[model samples]
Target chain A: MNANDPILETLNLVKEFKGFVAVNGVSLKLKRGSIHALIGPNGAGKTTVFNLLTKFLAPSSGMIFFNGVDITGERPAQTARRGIVRSFQISAVFPHMSVLENVRVALQRRLGNSYRFWQPENSLLQLNEHAMALLADVGLETFADTLTVELPYGRKRALELATTLATEPELMLLDEPTQGMGHEDVHRVTEMIRKAAVNRTILMVEHNMSVVSSIADTITVMQRGSVIAEGSYAEVSANPQVIEAYMGTTDTALQGAH
Target chain B: MRLTTYVYIALAALAVLAPLIGLYPVFVMKLLCFAIFACAFNLLLGYTGLLSFGHAAYFGAAAYTTGYLVKTLHWTPEVAILGGMALAAFSGLIVGAMAIRRQGIYFAMITLALAQMLYFVCLQLKLTGGEDGLQGVPRGNLFGMLSLSNDTTMYYFVLALFVTVFLLIRRIVHSPFGQILKAIRENEPRAVSLGYDVERYKLLAFVLSTTLAGLAGSLKTLVFGFATLSDVHWSMSGEVILMTLLGGVGTFFGPVLGAGIVVALQDNLADKVGSWVSVIIGAIFVVCVMAFRRGLVGEAQAFFGRKKKTA
Candidate 1:
């Protein structure tokens, strides 16, 4: 992978909340068409970085460049429209809507016809086939009619990814993609992420080193709002500073992995 | 879907027969106007999950606009109503733009403050007739052909508009656009990250809701031959919310039912209870909120849902 062909680059990013610095001078370069994982101790500001990249939270200082264009000042929706989509750490879906409608809403954005209130909803039925295909990709085809809130916890994360995929993202920012998932779900979601990463760049904050080791193309380790090390999983896990950051934390490199 | 047409027919038939069935056409027509207003508010509050405490602003603004247009400018009833609705939409755009910046209770407060501002402004403006209100707003001829001066004729005219707006609202709630609105209502941040531009959607819903509300307000002025301060008052805003809530927030005909119940209570009780009608309405609202928070339509739906599951 070309390290210089950065799809997303943050320059000295900082986010402060009422004098408490959440993200401090952290810069990251995501390679084009690669799965880059950011692993760090809890509260190391990995989620804040995701929020800043998606413009959910404004950076106190520094800049965000997407495909070489500065997108630091863009609104969250504007950032999403520019081919940057994100998934939340918690399962994020329209809980009252059926699983199929969840993806259809995202897919409908491409048609530019969601604003046509007069048109019969039968017009949206045309996109149902496409929505189901995305659902099938996520193994949610059987649950298409189920209201999203009825979905089990791990399944909701998959639905979030399915919805994220529906955005047709050029760059996907996933926060804790497999957080709180059981063994099987972690495996399924990890494989899904690997499958979904084709032709798109993914910057995910993952805690599961086994998952990272298996799927992540490169890993960036952060400590106290700063990057402690960056390289392949093998390289970063070997670094002393990276080990110290996760010393007291249950997650220490690939130690939790089999 | 077939059920809707039947429901509409049944509603129209009942409304058409109400005058002959011993109910005053004028009173029923007045109730219908507020029903329309509630349905419009329901679009934003029930469907979009936006609590706008200032909706009376659009309703009253249109009432005044339509009253002024017909009484002074001599515009046709339909065009005047449209003029009022357009103004309502414009004001909705501004109020919505500012209010949508905040969410939940903050959103409610912004709308309240804006509506109160309009209320006071209406007080000083000569166009609004100060506190006197724009009175003698003629019923005017429908298209300058069918005279609406007859109460029965005006009742039927209002019924027609009610049906149209009702169906229009139903269509919007079920359309792809409506789907986005519901998605925003369900999970706003998710809608935004999915590239739906939730703020723009919120503003659009707000404008649509307020515009329809204006239609109802304009009709009220035409119905009563006046647009008074009561129409623009903050209490009017609270009343619409009660109507929607009591009738079943978000249910298609809930606001209509809610408006009917509230208006009937006010009308029936006002003669007997006088100004204390407010106290009576307040008691009923408190009881409804405490007992069945879902409103009438919502409770019925829940009841039926439970029964179906059991059966």
Candidate 2:
């Protein structure tokens, strides 16, 4: 897509909690049909930025443009209806609900039938079929009837992704999609994210350098509530500030992984 | 199969056999009143994760209204009871608005405070007849056509209303709106992020629960032929919560079981030990919380769930 076709844009967005600035003067553009990676140090404010965009938190100052519309201070549900969906950093899937039921609830919310109460739930064949399709796409078809809390961590994360996808978002905000996972689990999730990016734009806050380098078309390095560097992985890898802020820290974690 | 369906079947069987049980119809009517109370209580604490300590306000308010309409205006039982339900719904809306401003323990405290205020109003109000209450309340006619003075007729009337309300609650729990409420209970922040208006959903649920509580109170007043301070007391609120906890908080039919068990215990033991019934409920609460968080039906479901897995 062209530069004019940006799906999401932040203009000098700032968020502060009391005296501490969680996200400061952060501005970024996510092009349509692209996988953009937001990389940072431990307190980089990447998740804060995601929260502001999704309307989970109001920005201290600035504007959020989604699909070329100003959506800065809209309610979370209003923003979600506009196709800006975010997965939680802590896997926000309903633990008491079955995997399929979780997806169906999201799907129902999207289809505008979430408020329908009089009819029997099983009578909604179209909704059920669509929910199953979403579950199948995320490789959770076998675990459809299983409670989300009973699922393995990797599967819970995948089910979370499936539930998010059920909202029919045009742009997905994933907060640390592959967090707390082994190499094989990371690989599986990276593949799933890559597959998901085929039809929808993804702005993900990822800590894993390997996953970022493998999948991100564009990478923005953030440090202490600001974008320190922005470019492709190869370009950012060569930047002195990015090298000192990100690579220096990532190398130590990489070595510690062994 | 869902345990709720089985419980419904069992309760239906009991209703059919009520006449052969050799029990007083008035006792069964009292049990039905508390059953509705417990179910209404469940809508908050069980499904919505809200702890309301002022349900007694709605329960007692409706009772007084129904008793006044029947005793003063000489209206039929049905009209008086419907008026009571409407009055309860209105009062619930007002109190629920204020109570919902606080959550968790604070929510319970707010409800208790408001209910206490209502209790004082009842005590001072002349229509409530002070401690004497509105006496000589004619059970009156069902629709100004069928007499409700016969205990059997009145028992079936109350039973039919109880079953209808119970089924309505079940339908609500299984609905999409109920699912969203559960999501709010499970993880509110996530539910909010998913585009649900968490506060609006909560307020709607609070209103619904309170309205149902009112209906039950109105029916109770008609059956007992008086409205007393007992229904409005904070202890009544505690009793409903205890029933829900004893039956199972969120599960369908749990509150019904809780209501029946608690009412039966009180009816059976109150004659012998008087007010010690509260002590026994407190003991059950402590035991249930410590060892069995699932209550009676919840534990049964869990047991069956494990068995199914093993099988």
Candidate 3:
């Protein structure tokens, strides 16, 4: 219950899929109210760490602690209920629902009325103003009534963020929040993430270095299922081992392309 | 108000006026019963995107129960129907718990297999009357007062039940709970991450669908004066799916339209074409799948939806 205790901590987490190790003995910590980034090259198992932390995948060995509670054996929904909500690498929205309704579904979960099937939906009209406010926060208020599937890819990502924000997570885990975005959307989302990071802890798996350097309070660099470096952006960027891992992967990828 | 709302009001008016217009009361009652059955089936297949190939279990089980109660116990019609519905809901809960552990085609196959088991149990049970089935089921008085012996009285009763169940389904589809079910259908992982107990929601939806299907079966037994092997057969489950798909799987009135067409087709062709009815129905299903794909109501909605956008 100490104020300065790490909001989330992992102790020697290991995940193996058959003969292959996806996350090997990875221990990490995030201080309260800080934005932490997990970055690595292709096949570096960055996504595996996020999955293990969110309990989407169980660890072969080790434990995860969130707010001084052990949650390694918890299910995905249980972890989310404990305030560790996540967004998918692929844009995940209720495609047929309107953008406003998408956020309202999340809000309805918070209100604990999702099981009230017998009641008229108009009784939920009171939630409209709050749902619209969340949409407005993500700049989706203009397209509030648009079906989520019809939205442009960038806007769908924004709507996804809006829905995730509706849950009011204590530790938000965003997997590739700005993946496949153009330059303009990348900047917009980075700023949005920075704004959202205030007064909450964030642990994100991002490939864009600019987004990582701009918003991340601490960076954990992984290579081949283990942490290679951990520090501030400047310190991690300058680390020889980190640079070598990136350069080595780029050369290997270029050679494979030939 | 939406155009669909106006259409629903007009349809309800026609239903009320049908018996007065010299239409066959018994035939219309049969159509109404099947329409309710199709709507209940659509709730799972169309809206929730769970294709249950075993809905006949609930529908037939309820029919048998209602038939037994009315014939043997001399229970009132209303009490018998409620009893059947409750039994169906309980059965739905047990079956749903096991079936929902799998997804996609596996789920469909499991439901089909379970329903086949139920069919065998019905065939062996003395209460179900085996092959000859439960016959001469009395359509008792409404609340032990008004006589349901008159065809017109029975037609109106069936119409009332149909409208009530239809409105209940409409209310549920637009409710907050329905929104969560749709979310789960669209992306289960995302719904799970949103802290919704997805399996529980799915189970509740299954129970709701089966209970309504049971209501329809009970009404059908009262209308036809029998609960036969045809009611519980796997082909009945397939017929409900056909109704939903042919009418438009996800559209509100699609199943009703599908059921009307199917029932009317069967009634007209059964005497004239002998066993060719199955062949003709199969042909129509193939054409619908290939050309329309969205079923009758769905295609009509899209057609008018485009017209509105252009206008």
Candidate 4:
């Protein structure tokens, strides 16, 4: 894709905590409606990158452009309002709330009606309908009445995705959506992301190489807080630098594929 | 558990039959006062996980305001109570803004120190009667008609205020803002990353808790027809903490039960044990911390939770 096709762009992104750079001089572009995968060894600063893009952390020096708008140093809510949303690597859920209530809260936040005090919106016909549709979309309708804490881990992840999707983001930044999942769950979430990608652009950090190899339209490899390689999965897999940095030195770059 | 409906029903029953409960109407008024105090504390500690130890500052400030207005200024009872609420809210807003900058243990200490400072200020202030505490506050008519000179009417009026405040708390807790508070408590970093202004939420919850604490303090002054140094003391702060802890921090009715039990215990024991009353309350606090962890309603919920799993 051409550079102009970028939906999200970060220029010279830098994040430092107590003089130790977590993310340093990182620049990347995410194309519209494409799955861009960020992969790195532990502490390659993938999560930091997500935090910076989501404005959870202010960059030390950088500019973030989403849909050609400068969003650097904006609050996370403002970023989210401008159609950017994120799901955490750890499960970020309201365990005390029912699944439906959790989705309804997100929907309520999206609708700007969460501050309404008088009536119970949980039972409202339109809100419940929209929430039920979201639950069904994420295949969580069966577990709708259950407390999110009671759901199996895989289902909690699904609920997280459903909740994030309810925010109506144009770009969804998912961090390790398949981590700690069984084989079946890994496949389920992989498929779910693929389905979700039809409407929203996805920028994900993936540790599972096979999952990334399958779903990633483009791959960006980072080490020591900087991008070391960027290309299509096939092209990047062929690059020997990626092999040495990620999988140790090998004569054939694609040797790990088998 | 759909428990809110049952709680409402029980509150209605209590409201109707409070006079027949055989507790002195004054003692009942005291119970209602502390119940409201506990509810306010719960808004922060229970919902926001922001424990505040200086709540007595707001509570005591309102008490002092009510006392001074009624006794020296001769303000009507309603006017005095409103003034107390307004002043308490202002106190909460200012203290909450500063205290919210710190989290966990530090927040508690900041509030404690602020309340202690207020207590000392109240101690020497002449309008507060310099430790004599604005004595002999007249119980004027409620709305300039039915005399609050009657104890039963005064008891009912306090009870009515308690119920209104409790229901308002319930409304706030179930509202969207309340849900956000729970979200913040459960995972603040996540709430912020999801676009919430978390500091603002904490500040607001703190302010609300302070205002309600003040409301309880003001009402207490009216029932007793005076405010004393007791209202502003560090011991009063400790007492309110004990009530919240014993009542169940987050559960709706736990504070009320906890308040009634603690107040009755203090009342009954005061004549026999005298100054040893603080020791006994402290002992209950230690025991609750060590054994109960969840207090009365919390333990009940846990027990029922296990049964639900079995069933």
Candidate 5:
């Protein structure tokens, strides 16, 4: 792949659920090593785009290229193995497993030892130190032995990030990483994401504007399943079309709150 | 040594001494066989979270296969059992492949439907002897050496196989592959994103459970000297589920304990209560579900676990 070529590119992606069009002919690109944010009001198809890119949902008519290779028909696990790992909008940690085990499982997948049923789990003990290191990276080292479900909400998100990072992904797709968090948690997680994006590509869907503005290198604003504005945070925040979309949604949300 | 290890040793010692203590060898052997069957079923339901309502298909299918081979072909008991196990594994592959396409209740229904179909097929087949089943199947010589016709010799053989299977399952449940199976059970989409092929893992687990259930059925045929329609019936499937649920869904020794209780209940109650045995079992099931939802061993563990925490 050429240096100037984007790491991920989508061409006229379309997704229709029976009569309703969830995502309509949206094209986008993510440059290498950049923290790109996908922001939109509710029903703007931001999540649909994320799902389409991760191969969790097939596009009705579109092409997705990762490293300039068409990956439209690949399965979710296939795309994951190709280094496109995603975190769910909900906290996706395995509740029954210990925090340490959650990360080691992902590391075990990376080592291709998932099919080794004959070997005892003690054989994977050597992975513990590395799993702990990743936990430390996400500030979850202290909770390594705790059951993941027992963790506080913010810590669970950190554990999810640690597990996702354990895959050593080339493209990390985080969906609403800071959703449903207090002010302290949002700030901590934003710092965690910034640290994690140092040498990798991150495409995140975040509703928290302060978090997005502080870390997002490029922001793409979406409205009605199409890209309404694309630029730096300041440029997109200043665009009239983006402003109108946000104002309309905010007004409707305020009315609904009544 | 761990407490469980000590418990296992004591249990083995008791099993070895049971015949000398006037305990009926054949009854004990029957209990061992059912315990193995229940353990195999638990491996899928408890650990993997795939409730297959069709386990009787593998168990009864293997019994028929082993009975036919030993009775008609005069094969050694070992060879017949292996043949039965292989056949069961193959059928498990086919059933598992189709059933895993759906999940939860749908998966259970599909398995139940497939097993019912197999039951009907067995009813019409010439080799299976239809409703009467393959009768008077010889126990035959073990490996063409030791005679398994003797009840005590057969008891030892059954006990040995049961212990081996139990240990093997324990090893599997602690293996890395088992860990992944647990992860898939806990969360499927997360497992997929972690790059583990969840379907393949589930299929392999299903096959393993089926092969072991076959092992149990083959031993039952050898011990009882018969294979019958009762073994393949849907009720047999339901019985195993009751045993697993009562013993503990995921605990290691729960199925064995559950099987023992169930077998003993049926054996003792069949003579005294006649048809009332089903009523008593239904009552116990209701009581168990209401008072001990985590199951016998599971509740015990929780009780002791809380004590330890407090201490």
Candidate 6:
């Protein structure tokens, strides 16, 4: 494919639950290696779009193309296998598993032994070094043996990122990865995301304007189930319509967000 | 060695010496059989977090199949047990495929529905002996030479399988496969997003659990010389859940201890209280749930851990 071609594309995607349209006539192109951010106000159908792209929710009509391959109608797991990995807005980790074991759960799938119950688990220690490396990347090496449920909320988010990283995806879809995290965690995670974005494409639904401005290479602003603007942070942030979408035509500029 | 290792050896010693010390061999065998049932059920409900209310279908299917094969075709005990496992696996596949489509309470409902169908078939089908149940299952020689006819001999035979399964379960729980099951149990949607075909993992867990439960049923048939309606009833399924919960739902030794207590209560109180046995069991279940939600072994471990901390 051409370098100019989008690495991922959705043509006129529409999702309706019952009679309400959640995502309507949305079309977009994600450039190769770009840190694309999908930002919108509450109820703007951002999460619904993520769900549709990952095949968690079947679209009422439209298509999803990944790396120029038609990947619509694939199973949710099939979507994941096609190198599109998404993280939940809620922190997701196996609670009872040790922090190390949580990351190993993701890494072990690549070892091609997902169904070998007869073998001793000691065999899985071979993955310990790799699992520990991922945890170390997230600064979680010290808490390796701690149960995930007992970790503080912010650390759980970091562990969630670590587990997501263990999947080694080509395209990472992060849904509000820093939604409830404190300021310090948000900056740490933002830096971690920038570090993690080295060789892969990241499409994130982020609300933090400062995060969007700092790291997002391209911003797609949605207003009530449609993309109102798409451009660099400077272009989208400066647009009056984008400003109206957020602050509702108030005298205060969109600058109020930061 | 660790303290747990010493505890295991001591427990093994007790099991080996039980019949000699006047604990009835048949009673011990019966409890062990139920222990296996509870353990198998725990693998699904406790580990996988899939509550299957219809597990009796697989257990009873194996018991009935073994009863038929041994009583009529005169199959060897080893072959007969394998036959029972195969039937259980097959039945488990059918039940699991349909049941796993719905989750949580709905999943439990569907399994219960399918199992009730199996129970009716057992009650109506002539092959299952209708109401009289599949009776006269033989305790034939284990390998065509070593007899299981004597209660002590059969006890060891059953004991060997029990110990193997206990360790096997611990291994499985620690295995990579078990980790996937735990991931699913902890967060199913997240597991799906991780590219796991969650339905397949759940189905496999269901099949493995049913087959183990089937092995226990087959042994019970051979032990008691019968596969009766009680084994096939919905109450049997509920009883297994009770055993798991009473002993501790997710703990490794919880099911074993729960099965022991439950089976002991039934054996001792059946003559004294008649049908009041169920009422007593129900009371115990409520008391256990309210008083010790962690289960006997789980609470013991927590208590022990506390004592260790103080010391």
Q: Which stretches of candidate 6 lie over 4 Å from their true place?
A: A256-258, B1-3, B309-311
> Where is the poorest 10-residue window by lDDT in model 2 chain A?
A249-258
Q: Return the TM-scores of chain A for each candidate in numbered order.
A: 0.95, 0.93, 0.95, 0.94, 0.95, 0.97
Clashes of each: 0, 1, 0, 1, 0, 0
Looking at model 1 chain B, report the run of 10 residues with the lowest lDDT sum: B1-10
> For residues B1-311, what per-residue lDDT tens digits would candidate 4 score against the true structure?
76657977887897768788775888888888999998888877887898888888899999999888888887889888999989999999988888897988998899999989998999898888886887788888877777898888898888888888888888878877777777777777667656677788788888888889989999889888888888888878878778888989898888888898899998999999998987888888899999999998889889888988999
What is candidate 4's DockQ? Answer: 0.45
Per-residue lDDT tens digits for candidate 6, residues B26-111, read 99999999999999999998998899998888889999999999999999998999999999999999889888878799999999
CAPRI-style docking class of model 6 based on DockQ:
high
Give candidate 1 misplaced runs (Cα > 4 Å).
A1-4, A248-254, B1-9
Quantify all predictions' global Cα lDDT against the true fold: 0.91, 0.85, 0.91, 0.85, 0.91, 0.91
- What's the distance in Å from true for residue B80, model 1? 1.0
Q: Which of the CAPRI classes, incorrect, acceptable, medium or high, describes model 1?
A: high
TM-score of chain B, candidate 4? 0.95
Clashing pairs in 3: none
Candidate number achieving the greatest DockQ relative to the actual structure: 1
Question: Which residue runs of candidate 5 sit more than 4 Å off their true CA positions?
Answer: A249-258, B1-6
Question: Would you list the clashing residue pairs of candidate 6?
Answer: none
Candidate 2 lDDT, B139-227, residue by residue in tens: 99888899988988888998999988888888777888888888888888778767787777888888888888989998888888888
What does DockQ give for each predicted structure?
Answer: 0.87, 0.58, 0.78, 0.45, 0.77, 0.84
Model 4, range A1-258, lDDT digits (tens) per residue?
A: 354578999999999999799999998889898999998888899999998999888999989999888999688877887888899998888898889887876776666655544345353346788989999998899888998889999999999999888888889999999999988999989999999999779999988888999899999999879999999888888788877776667665653322
Estimate, for each residue in B48-156, the C-alpha lDDT of model 1 and write its tens digit: 9999999999999999999999999999999999999999999999999888989799999999999999999999999999999998889888898989999888888
Q: In model 2, state the lDDT of residue A2.
A: 56
Query: TM-scores across all candidates?
Result: 0.97, 0.92, 0.96, 0.94, 0.96, 0.97
Off by over 4 Å in 2: A1-5, A247-258, B1-11, B99-102
Please give the lDDT score for candidate 1. 0.91
